[model samples]
Every structure is written in C-alpha cells, then in structure tokens.
Target chain A: MPKVLMKGNEAIGEAAIRAGCLNYFAYPITPQSEVAEYLVRRMPEVGGVFLQGESEVAVGYMLFGAAGAGARVFTTSSSPGISLMSEAISYIAGAQCPAVFVNIVRGGPGLGGILPSQGDYFQATKGIGHGDCRMLVMAPASVQEAVEMVMKAFPLAEKYRNPVMVLGDGLIGQMMEPVEFPDHLKSEPTNKDAWSTNGMDHRNSKKRNIVKSLFLDPALLNDNNLQLKAKYDQMRSDEVMFEAYNTDSEYKGLVVSFGTMSRVCRTAIDLMKADGIEIAMIRPKTLFPFPEKAVADASKKPTCTHIISVEMNMGQMVEDVDLSVKGHLPVSWYGKCGGEIPTPEEIIDVVKSRIA
Target chain B: MQSEVMFAGFGGQGILVMGKILAHAAMEEKYEVAWVPSYGPEMRGGTAYCTVVIADHPIGSPIIKNPKHLVAMNGPSLEKFAPTVKKGGVIFINRSLISFGANRDDVDELAVKIMEIAKDLGSVKAANIVALSAFVARSGIVSMEALKHCIKEEFSNKPKLIPLNMEAVVAGEKAGKK
Candidate 1:
C-alpha cells in the first residue's frame, strides 16, 4: 500500500473507521478538533454515525451509550475535555463496556494551555476517574503509530471488554507525516452480544444484558472489583508494549519517555552518542501495563547509573520510572510545561548533569 | 540525510502553507517528513512559523531548534530566525518586505523580492509560493517538478489560482538562479 501524507488527528480518525468503528461522538477541542472535522464527512460516506454532542460531557455519555449497545464507538478530546469525560469513562470501565477514547493531550493543571504535553500521564495511567478501574492506554509517538494504535485500540477494547485510550500530545495530534494504514490491522470487532445491550432480538435470545455500574450488594460489588482486578492483571502480563532505542548496547544512563517527547530523547541520545556519552532510551508504547520490566531491565544495565524521565510536563512519568527502577538506580526528571517543548540540547544537558 | 526548514512570517502570509507544500513534496518523493506549526493565539495576526523536517530515515524531533534552512517572509521573521539557521545552511529572505538581511557570514543567503515578483505575476498572495520556489531551487531539498505537482494538488480546489502560482514559481526560480 502507498503511504499518504496525513495529520496525526485525521490519521487516527481514518484508522478508527478502517478498524470498523462506525460510530463517533465528540466535542470540538483544539489540537484534536481535526479528528471530528475529518470524521464528519467521512463517517457518513462509510454509512457510519458521526455526531457533535452539545458538550464534552454529553459526548462522553453518548459514547458510553453507543459502546454499551455493542457498537464500536470512539471519541477524541484534549486535556480539559478529557477531564469532563472522566466520569463517563469511569462508568464505562465499571460497566465493562468497550470504547476507544483518544486524548490528544495538551498542557493542563486546569485549562493550562493547548500545546503538546504529557501532564495527563498520571491521570491516564493511574486515575482517570474515581474508581478502582484501569484503562488500557496506548501512547503513540508518530502519526503512523497513532494510526496503528487507533486501529489496534478497537480490538484491544473488545478483547478485554475495557475502554482503551490512545494518548498523544499536541505535536502528534498536529504534525503531518507519511502513513499507510496496514490492511492487517483492520479487523472485525469481536462479538459483544454476550455482554452488550444490543437488544434482546439482535442477540436472538430473550435474556437482556443490562449494562450498569451499580452493584447494590456489597458482595456483588466486591466480586466485580475482584474480576476487574484480575482482568487488569491479565492485561499487565499480556499487553505491555515498548520500544527500545540503543538499549542493546551498554549505556551510562537510561532515558524514559513516551509519545512526541521520546523523539526529542532520541535526538538527544544521538547527539550525546556522537560526543562519546552513551545513553539509551525506552519509549513505552503502552502507558498503562506500564512496561515496568522493560524499564527495570534497562535501568539494571551495569553501566547505567541514572534513569531520567523526559516529558513535556513537570515530572509525571518520572514516578513510574522511579517505580520501575525500584531504588536500584536514581530516577531524575527534565521537563518543560505550559506548551514549551524541551530541545534536544536541553535534554542532553539534563542527562549530562544527572550522570556527570 | 535530513533537511530541516523553518518558514516564518505574518499569519496571513501563508508561511504554514509553504511548509506544508514542501512537506507534501518531500512525502511524494518518498522521504520521511514532519510538519509542525506554531499554533495558538499568536496565530491570529502575530508572527507564525512552522518547521518542516525531511529525512531519508525517520525524523527524530519535529521541533527543530536550529534548522538547516529558513524562509523569512517579513522583517520580524528574518530578525528572529536568521541567526538560528545552522552554519553552511541557507536563509531565503523576502526582500520585498524586509529591509535588513541575514548577517551570518558562514551561511549562504538569498534575498529574493518574492512579494514584488508575485505582484508582477498578479497575485500578491502567491508570494509564499514564490519564496518556496526560490528555496527549493537553491537548496535542491526537493525537486522543482515535485513542488509544482504539490502546488497543483494543494490548489486543486481553487483551480483558477494554479496558473498564477506556477508563474510565481517560475519567476522565483529565475530570481534564485540569478
């Protein structure tokens, strides 16, 4: 297949469609509005449903309702918008509904700024909402990876019957890159009839599956939480994905980053390597299922003395890096927030300061 | 090999489109490319800029600190980005708007009267195309033929502007050759 030049947001929208997701509900937000804009014309052309809800809050429930009804549905939003949807996301996760949410993250403590940021790292991988629920989060670094991750998201959501989040920063959302949507990644969604409220007649059974997060009995609620925990454990063992750059060789320090920030680290690693300062990188492709072992192993390298987390925000992912290193190595952080991206030279300086 | 180019000008000057076209042309030529725009409130009337990175291998960072080339369409853009161009790199300045030029002695500088050339071609808005043509012609980062094809495709919806854009490209190319 020939590659086509596409923006990351539009590529994700197209990838969702190719992945056989026919329903999309979203509210317009900068750095990610392009996804809704692209899908508006595209969904109808494919005999799908596209809707711009009254607000991000409304769209979250709409996606929940759609996904609960056994339709492959998705939505895209930025930081503040994602915050609005966290309630619904929690509901969907608790109910064990399959949905895909793409958070083209921007700087935010609260409406911080609409630039590339990883500030949502803790929110995404740790607590998106008030629950014991965990989401399958995939962080893609490039437009092509964004496309692949979106395509993979649908099946992954259905596989675990859990909501999957494709997390990227504004750079990945806005930048244009060459991409080819591989045919192999396109697949029919798995059967949701057993658990979905697809109408009694659609399932050819009189029994109706009720989708709700409310468990009145304490025992039943505890059982549900235990089951969710088991599923999460299964995911941790099965779905941890990451990319290693120059990890095969011995290094003085290890850099951990994801999404667009990882690309900056790659350039820094290259520059430092040229200057005879060896550094390796581990870019976690999946933010949740956090690639803990991969990071731990890399940090355990005999020559590796420091683990640095480079992000677009102040020290979010560094906590995870700290956990992965487990005090065997010191974890440091370098970041620029409120829409400022750290330059490769700046990152190199940080690495040097830490390891020196 | 990689070539990183930064295009900067006033918001309405089509600086982003120039970067987009170059990025599209590079993609057409089977190169890995990334185009990142400086997007925000400043984009309303403030100086706008975008970076286009074209590489034989995958691009590491889309946010380039020191670009290999620069297309500065106005005085502020030139004043701001000229020094950031790497040594031995090129700076293509739109002399029609800027009185000052790049002070760098190490890098090659081409100051083309792009707006004046586009005005002669009867389309002032085509000035970006003019500057883009000169940059491509001088740097050879992308073939002129590929750029022409990209321009046609980009303006395919507004077919009426195609001829004027092509004329602007030719005029700029001639100016660049001189």
Candidate 2:
C-alpha cells in the first residue's frame, strides 16, 4: 500500500472515482468544497463528468438524471445544501435508484454555523425528507475510513437498491492523514439498464422500462410504504456496525459517539483509563442501523450505569441513545454546537462526573 | 495529558511543514498525534497556524484553544498565541521577525535568531526547521531519534530536500545547546 497524505474531503472524491462513479454533481459549501474541487480536475482525467451544478436543487435533479440512466453517480454537500437535496433524495429512494451521497455536515438549526457538527444526525438517520424512504448512512471517523466507506458504498447501495450516505463533519472533511488506496481495486462499470430509464436500442425496444414513483392508488402507496419498512427492518439486521474498545474489562459506563466525535471519545477513554477511570466506548460505524444492541448490552450491567453521547451537535444522537437503552440506564449528553469540537480532557471530565 | 503546539508564520515560510514533521515524529515515537492546518482566507498571504496534538494515548478534540508549546514564526503569531501557553511551557520565537518578545511570566521563552542562522546557512526557508530542532533539543519534549525518525518519514516522499533539511536540523540542535 502506498501512503499519501490526503485530506478527508479529497479522499472521498478519490474513493468515488475508484468506485466507478463516472458522474459527480455538487454545490460548494464550507469544508466539503475540497472534495468537489478535487473531483473537478480528477474526474476529467478519468473520463468522468464533474458538474458544478447551478444550485444544490439542480445538483439533486442532475443526480436523478444520471442515476436514472443507470450510471454510478455521487454528490456531496453540507447541512443547508443537503436540506435542498432532501426532496430529490426522497425521489431517488422512491424510484429505488442506487447512488452515493456524502454529507460532510456542518452545524445547523437554520444556517447555524460553518463549524463541523453532528447536528444533522437525526436528519441523516431518520430520513430527512417527506414520504416513506430509507438510506444507508455510514459514519466515517477518519479520512481513511472515509475513503474505505466510499469504496464500499457502491456495492452496498447496489445490493440494497438505495442511496448510501457517507456522513461526516467539516473537520473530518478538512483534516489530513495518510491514506492508502486499496491494492487491486478496480472499477467495473455496472450495467443497471434493467431498472434505468435510459432509452433502449431498437434491438432491445421490445422490452421497456420506466422509473417512476407515482402510485395514484392509496392502497398501492400503503403497500410501497410497507415494502420500504421491510427493507429498513432487514437493514437493521444486516447493516448495524460498531467498534468496542476495552469492553472486555469491567467498565463503569459506555460512551456512544460516531464519526470524528468517536475518535475524540476514544482518546478520552484512554486518558480516563490511565487516570484510573474504567470507561469504554461503543463507536457506531453505521449511523442508521445504529448498533442499538451493542448499546443495550452495555447497559445490562449494573456497573455500566451511564450512557454518554458526545457529538458536535447540541444533542441529536442522545435521543437515539435514550431510545436504545430504553430507560434501563440514564443517558447523558455533552457536546458543543456549531464547529467547536470537544477535546478529550473535556469529555473525560464529563464522563468522570457522570460516573461519579 | 495532551500536548498541544502551534506553529505559525506566513504562507511559504515552512511553518505548516515543520508542524507536520513534528507531528509525524510524535507518531513514530508511539504517541497519538493529530495535525490540523489553518484553512480559508487566513492561509492566503496572512498568518497561518497549524495545531499539532501529541499524547501518550489517543488524543481527544484536536482543537487546542491554549496550546502548551508555541513556535511563533512571526510577530502576529507570537502576539496572538503567547498568553495562552501553559505556565512553564516553552514559547520558541523566531527572533529575526518577532522582535516583541513574549510577556507571560508563567511561560518559558526561548528567543532564537533562527532566520539569522538560516541566512548564515543560506536561506530563510530553513528557519522553521531550525526553530523546530531548537525546540525539540531544549524542551526535550520529543527525543532526537523521534525527530530524526519523523524527518525521514516526512522526507521519504520529497527525497530531493532531505539533505538541506537535515543540515538545518543539525544547525538547530547545535544552536539550542544552552
């Protein structure tokens, strides 16, 4: 493996390119703009289309156009821009289109701030748009993980016939680390023509394919919702992913965090452990199918009495932690909104206080 | 405990590179490390600072509002970050540019005329490396082997510049002998 220093945003772009995504559509936003800038030059080199869409709205539609034609497509944006694309995201899910979306999140209630934050956790996991739809949300804590997830997302999205999002924060988007491109990774063009709306040649004209979500009948809509719900149920079993550290030992409480926040939590746990505090962390890699079992299991022990959720948001994921623990254990939250990241010492202090 | 350092100067002054080299060294020394560069408009002809965190274990938060070690290559950087240095922590300043010395009594200040030494050695670009070398030698925060290990790793890709930077490191180490 050849190691090259790369920014998280640029790694996402390179991974998409390697994953055979020939088309990219996005609008500029803080932190994530580097991925777009990287693709601007890189996509052309690889015989791909890189479009700086007129707006996030146009970019979403363009992604729909590309995915409809059976092309591997990708687009990335931050919080507010993602809000604009939520409508198209719903449409893609309704159409059962396979594509990748990267949300390098920033703080936001409404144009909240430019700093990195997990405020969009609920939006990404709960299906931000109207209507019945679900997306595969992968949270990457480092640039290396970001690259690997983007590569893995293609197959995962195709398998589920849904959009897979690599959700992260601005800091993770901008931070630099050595990344190694997977050896022997090759991009094989996927022929999704069976489901795509691209016009078939005369030789294949006898068979027609149309991609639409217009179920005029109410019963059909209900049936579609049921089918979507079933897919989500299956995903809960198939997609939940997490990492446990120092969990084998007797621990006091479990720390729940994701993305860049998890990296910080790991450091905090190490520090507290060295200082004689026996804390552990359950880092969720899949934000949607949130390894709820792991969290619940951690709460089963009487000594592990607290579940602390740390994030860049005010408190988006704490709700999920609460739901997972089901009031069996008290769930607490310590976080900063906007772009501010909580240091390990601060988190250690918070965890110690909670344990006490 | 987490150790934070800020290396700041104008763009093209090698401030960021030096910070990265130090971070890489810490990592090689088996310490957890994080290197965050200044982004946005501040990087264009203005003061640029990169924060580096090195810890015995994993690092948390990566954002240090009060860095323990400061390598201010210019006046503004020293002025901006001086007061935040922890008491007894070292502040290594480039005496050629930052004439206004640090005022904090709690922090230990090392005034190195790194630019003058680099000029004697033939270029201003070496000043950042020299200051880093001086800090490493005097502060003993990182071992010489670790610094050399980091230098080798950082220069492994840019093979052409290794000799000059190594010489600068030598010059810095020699100069820091107090």
Candidate 3:
C-alpha cells in the first residue's frame, strides 16, 4: 500500500484490522480516544467487534474474556485508563493468554493532563499490576513505527503466551504522519486450541481448556511464577531491540532515550554534529528486555565520558539506564514532566552541560 | 533543509485542517511531514492551532518551539505566536480580524483580509484556504502545483466545493505574490 497521510490514533485502528485482529475493547481517553472513535465505525465494516465498556476496569476484563477464548484481542488507553486496566492485565498475564495493549501515555499520577508523556515507564516495565507480571514492552517513536509495532505485538504475545505492550506517548496518538500498512496478514489462528477455552470438540484433545489465573496451591503458584519468569528471561536473550545513532565516532556522551524524547534528542545530536561536537544516542525500541548490552557497550567505549537519560517524565527511564550502565559511567537524567516537552535546543544545552 | 509552519486561529476557523493540507502537500512532494495539533483543553470559540514540519530527512522532533513560519488567522494568535517565529520566515496575519502587526521587523508579514477575500469570492468559510494558499505561495516550501493538487484531493469528496476552493486558492496565491 502506498503511504497515506493519517493521524496516529486512526492508523493504529486500521493496523489492527489489517493484522487480522477483530476484537477491540476500549474506553475513551484523551489523546487516544480517536482509536475508539475510528474503530467503532471501522469494526462493523470489517465484520469485527468493537465494544466500549462502562469503564476501563470493565473493558480490561472484556479483553481477558476474548483473549481466553483465543481471539486476537486488544485495547488502547491512556495513563489512568491503563491504571484501571492493570488488574485485568495481571490476570491475563497469569492465565498465560496472548493479548495486546497500546498505552498512548498521558501525564499523570492522577487525572493530571492530556499531553504526551513517558511517565508510565516504571509502571509498564516494573509493575503493571502486581505479582510477577512483566509485559514485553515495545516503544515506537513515530506513527509508522507505532503501526509496525502494533502489528508485530500480536505474534510476539502469542509466542510466549503473555501480554505485549506497544507504549507510545500522547504525540504518537495525536499527530498525523504518512503510514503504509504492511501487505502481509496473518489471519491464520495460532496453535492455541490446546490452551484456549474454545470447547473440547474444537481441539484434537479431550482435555477441557480451563482459563483461570488462580493457582491456589503454593507449589503450583510457584511453578506458574517460575514459568512467567522464564518467558521474561528468554525475551532478554531473544527479543532485545534498539537503535544506535552517531555511535561510530568518538562522541563525548551517550544519550539514553525512547519514544518522542529520543526523536528530540536525535535532532539535538544532528545539530551538535554540525558544531564539531559529536554526541551519540541509543534509542531503545523495546523497553522491557531492554537493550542493556547495547547501552552498556556503547557507553563503555573509551571516548564516551558521561551518559544521560533524557525523558518527558521525572527520571523514570534513567533508573533503567543506570541499571543498564552498571556504574561504568556517571549516569544522570534531564526531564520536564509537566506535559511540556523539552525542545531540541534545551536537549542540546543539557548535553553540553553533561559533557562540560 | 527543514521548515516548520504554525497555523493558529479560532477553533471553528479550520486551523487544524489548514495545517493538514500543508502537510499533505509536503508529503506528496516526498518530504517527510508531521502535523501536530493543539489537542489540549480548548473549546469551539477558544484557541486552536497546529504545526506542520516538513523535512528532507526523517523528522526528528515534532515539538517545534520556534517555527519557521506563522499564519495567524486572528488577533490573539498573532500576539501569542508571532514572537516565537524565527526571523527570515513568513508570518501571515488575517488583517480583517487582527489590527496589530507582529511587532517584529526581521520576519516577512503578509497581512491579508482572508475573510473578506473569501466572502468576495463566495463564502467566508474559504478564509482558511485563502490564508493557506497565500502562505504557501509566499513561502514556496511546497510547489504551487503540488499545493493545488493536494487541495483538490482534500476536497475530492465535496465535488461541488472543489471549484470554489480552487478559486479561493488562486485568489490567495495572487494576494500572496503581492
């Protein structure tokens, strides 16, 4: 398909349809409500189902129910909406169901504002809901990338039988850009009949598929936790993705950033290059199963002196950057979390200060 | 290598649509483009604005603090955004709605009475097209041919309105050259 100019939110809905995902359950939220708006009309045309629950909490369980029945299901929400859905996220993860969640993050501890933010870094990567729940998180910097990530998320979710997250900021939801839907469609159902509760007659086996998160026995629960932990470990080795910019030259510092913040830093790096002062940036495409080795290796180079994590939130990703660097370099954070994005000039100034 | 245009006006004034048209033009020309709107808390008569960035390479940042151009369709828009426009860029002001200048000498100001011009052509709704076409003619960021084509394609569904919009585009282009 030729590239057509489209808003990020609307394109995401189309991408899901193209990816053969027919079930979309979500509640309306700023910066991302367009997804629901687009899908409500779109789903019917494609013979798919689009449902808006009374609230996000109800919507989350709707996802659990659909995903348990082995239908490609997903939801889109903002910060607080995602918070409301966290319990269902944990339950879905524990039940080992494949589902996709797109969080177009807005600023918040509470109903803060409807603006682009990376505040949910910790929530998405560390603690989404509770108890050994770690979603395989992919962060896209552009609308095209957002579409691509959402398409790739479903297969990855099924690969490990876990929830995969496509984490974007408000800008990725609100902005318009040129996007082309991928030609290939994997409408073929995955090999999930053995686990999915689609009834005994549907699958080859006589054993009924029981989809539940509750493993009441201590040993059984331990086994389930270990199984989830093993999937995470495998992701660490297999699915780490990142982009390294201007890393070839002897740059003074390494910038660790993701999503829209990284795009701003990319501009800053280009400007700094023209000034004869080179700076490198490592943008992690996958937040979890993070590009730890890439960051550590890029920063450990003899020429790279200081490393800084630039973000829209108050130093959330910096912690992960620090953990990745492992004290090899003096790690610091520069941010403006009050819904105001740091410009290229501001990022350039911060990098200068870090090097100085 | 890159140019950023800011379109600001009242909410009902089609500011976002103006920016989208410019973005589509740029994309048709094969330049990477991004259109970001002010999706903040604003009402119908309240403030509305959008920024369009066109770059030869991939657009690095969509959050443009200082735009290369400003097309202000109202008084408050010019006053709020005029100061932030970079020097040596075009600033289009709707003189019919705004009386004051941009208060700067470094930028090029094309103060046109878009509403009056659109009204003279036929309807007042074409004010945004007048302003947009005029600004594109002045800036030359995208070719005039490309801009016109995109405008036609944008109004493709409304076959009846295409001719009027095209007329508005030509009128604005003529006004922009002056």
Colliding residue pairs in candidate 1: none
Highest lDDT model number:
3
lDDT of 1 by residue, B36-155 (tens): 988875737888999999999988988898999999988888898898899998899889888887999999899988877888889789989989999999888999999999999999
lDDT of candidate 3 over A167-262, digit per residue (tens): 999999999999989975676457678568988777777777889999999999999999999999999999999999999989999999999999
User: Each prediction's DockQ?
Assistant: 0.82, 0.40, 0.91
Give model 1's TM-score versus the native structure. Answer: 0.97
Instruction: Give the residue spans of candidate 3 off by over 4 A.
Output: none
Quantify all predictions' global Cα lDDT against the true fold: 0.90, 0.83, 0.93
lDDT of 3 at B29: 94
Error of 1 at A331 (Å): 1.5
When sorted by TM-score, best at the front, the candidate numbers are 3, 1, 2
Ranking by DockQ: 3, 1, 2
Identify the superior model by lDDT, candidate 2 or candidate 3.
Answer: 3
lDDT per residue, candidate 1, A193-287, as tens digits?
A: 76788767778556668899999999999999998999999999999999999997779999999999999899889989899889999999999
- The i-RMS of every model, in angstroms, reads 0.8, 2.9, 0.5
Per-residue lDDT of candidate 3, residues B115-161 (tens digit): 99999999999999999999989999899899899989999999899
